[model samples]
Target: MRAALFQMTSGVDPAVNAAAIVDAIGRAKAGGADMLFTPEMAGCLDRDRTRAAATLRSEADDPVLAAVRDAAAKAGLWVHIGSLPLKDERADGRWANRSFLIDDRGAIRARYDKIHLFDVDLASDESWRESSVYGPGEQVVAADTPWGRMGFSICYDMRFPDLYRALTNAGATILLAPAAFTVPTGQAHWHVLLRARAIEAGCFMIATAQVGLHEDGRTTYGHSLVVDPWGAVLLDMGDVGGLAFADLDMGQVADVRGRVPAITNRRDIPAQVTLA
Candidate 1:
């Protein structure tokens, strides 16, 4: 399968970010890509909650989602919109960090609200409390694609291996991890974690990321990568934001699993263990 990855430096404006994704859709189709993947927070990345809240809309009303779906249909390309911050209807009034899988016909195939939220205090003294604003997701989502069953995840979710194991156990051959990572963490752990997940699961790992400085006065570590089941880095768009393509061999998933068979060999861990 031919995949297009868009590494973007999304700003505070939804319209501007939508336009960039739309353009990438057209370009991906023109380049003969079957699917396009984008970074997390593709719609808007604003640090200030008050400012971001004004731009956040429901999935039904989000202009960015609308534009991407329309463009995907027009381009006849499958799109994995990394994640959009959308207003949630729950009583707590928190928003959701949601990812979408749009079919070639512009239909909503599946939606995955980010299960793990980034709540960290970095060594650089930068801190984020995602749970304060966004509620955690309850379900794990995977959807059928032309390539294979693709599992979904957002930024901080990459650090958790159990999520990927659950996905592979459910028959997912390709995993999507779109992120807007902080520079310090990204530099230290990004590639290592992604590669480890792919290796352990024996599945393809696609991570498209946010790059460069943004309108919100923050910088992101942007090395968008596509790793094969064998833990090979197929494509890495290093530190720059634009459209990049990679050709995936779906058959490799089976080949790698046949050799390693990690997923098939997996056994349930006992609930309690004695101290060594």
Candidate 2:
């Protein structure tokens, strides 16, 4: 499968971000890409909640989502919109960090709200409290595609191995992790964690990321990567933001799994462990 990964520096305006994605859809199709993957917060990346709230909208009302669906349909291309921050319907009034899988016809095939939120205090003095604004998702999602069953995740979700194991157990051969990572953490853990997940699950790992400085006065480490089931880095778009492509051999998943057999040999751990 030919995949196009868009690494972008999203700003406060959803319209501007939408335009970038729309243009990328055409470019990706022209490049003979069957699917396009975008980074998390592709709609808008605003740090200030007060300012972002004014711009945030429900999924049905989001201009970015609307535009991308239209563009995807026009281009006849599948799209994995890494994640969008949308106003949730919950009584608590918290929002959702949602990922979407759009079919070639522009229909929403599946939606996955981020199960794990980034709540960390970084050594670089950067801190995040994602749960303070976004409610956690309860479901683990996987959807059918031309390539194979694809698992969904966003940003901080990469740190959790159980999630990937669950997806692999659900018959997913390709895992998607869209992220907006802080430079410090991205530098230290991004590649290793992504590779580990792919190796452990014996599945392909596609991680498209947000890169460079944004309008919100924050910098992101932008190494958008695609890892094979054998833990090989297929493509890595460095700090610069643009469109990059990778050719995936779906056969690799089965080949690697047969060689390692990690997933088949996995034994469930008990909830309680006795002290050694």
lDDT (10s digit) by residue, model 2, range 1-276: 999999999999999999999999999999999999999999999989999999999998999999999999999999999999999545688998999999989999999999998888888788899999999999999999989999999999999999999999999999999999999999899999999999999999999999999999999999999999999999999999999999999999999989999989999899998999
- Clash-forming residue pairs, model 1: none
Count of steric clashes across candidates, in order: 0, 0
- Per-residue lDDT over 1-276 for candidate 1, one digit per residue giving the tens place of the 0 to 100 score: 999999999999999999999999999999999999999999999989999988889998999999999999988999999999999645688898999999999999999999998898888999999999999998999999989999999989998999998998899999999999999999999999999999998999999999999999999999999999999999999999999999999999999999988888889999999899
Error (Å) of candidate 2 at residue 105 is 0.7
Instruction: Spell out the clash pairs found in candidate 2.
Output: none
The window of 10 residues in a row where model 1 has the poorest summed lDDT is: 88-97
Q: Residue 107 in candidate 1 has what lDDT?
A: 97
lDDT of each: 0.95, 0.96
Give the poorly placed runs of model 2, Cα more than 4 Å off. none
| Error in Å for residue 147 of model 1 | 0.8
